[model samples]
Target: MFGILVSAFNVALGFVLRTVVVKFILFFGLYFVVQAFVPVLASLLPKSVDIAGLFSSLPDSVWFFVNMFMVTEGIKLMFSALLTRFIIRRIPLIG
Candidate 1:
């Protein structure tokens, strides 16, 4: 019973650690890669556009909700890709 409990604890700890590490890598890796395009994206915007006015029109609550939703979706998509690859590799016929 003790051995079984130890094994189960090890497996859970391993999974938790793997998840944290993978999420950190995926989040920051994608963040830096996307940040590299900031200048190009900025240049594409028309200089005459009123950026401040555009943001000022929206309520703070709306902005907060949108940002939260976008962040949640992005993380979910990134993790899903990792999970899909894991699933694909586990298929006996695929290997």
Candidate 2:
């Protein structure tokens, strides 16, 4: 019983450390990258049109949602691939 409890606790702790913490760090890193580059990217667009007006037309919520979605999907893919590799390594002999 103690062994089982210890195993469960370890698994939960590992998940928090490996998945949650790592994902949070990666998400913030990606956000900073985007924030740093967005102005540069915007400047690259053709200046004949009113880019500022187009950007201002959208509500802050829309940009937040899009950014969240992109970061989440990217993290999901990265985590899935990492989990798959872990599982593969754990497989008996075949791994």
**Per-candidate RMSD vs. true structure?**
13.6, 15.6
What's the true lDDT of residue 63 in model 2? 70
- Per-model CA lDDT versus the true structure: 0.71, 0.72
Candidate 2 achieves a global lDDT of 0.72
Tell me how candidate 1 scores on lDDT: 0.71
Q: Who wins the lDDT comparison?
A: 2
Q: Taking the tens digit of each residue's C-alpha lDDT, what string does model 1 give over 1-95?
A: 99999999999999988998887887676567556655665577578957558757888888898687785477669967875575445444453
lDDT of 2 by residue, 31-56 (tens): 67656665675577576966457657
TM-score of each: 0.41, 0.46
Query: In model 1, what is the error at residue 46, expressed in angstroms?
Result: 2.5
Instruction: Give candidate 2's TM-score.
Output: 0.46
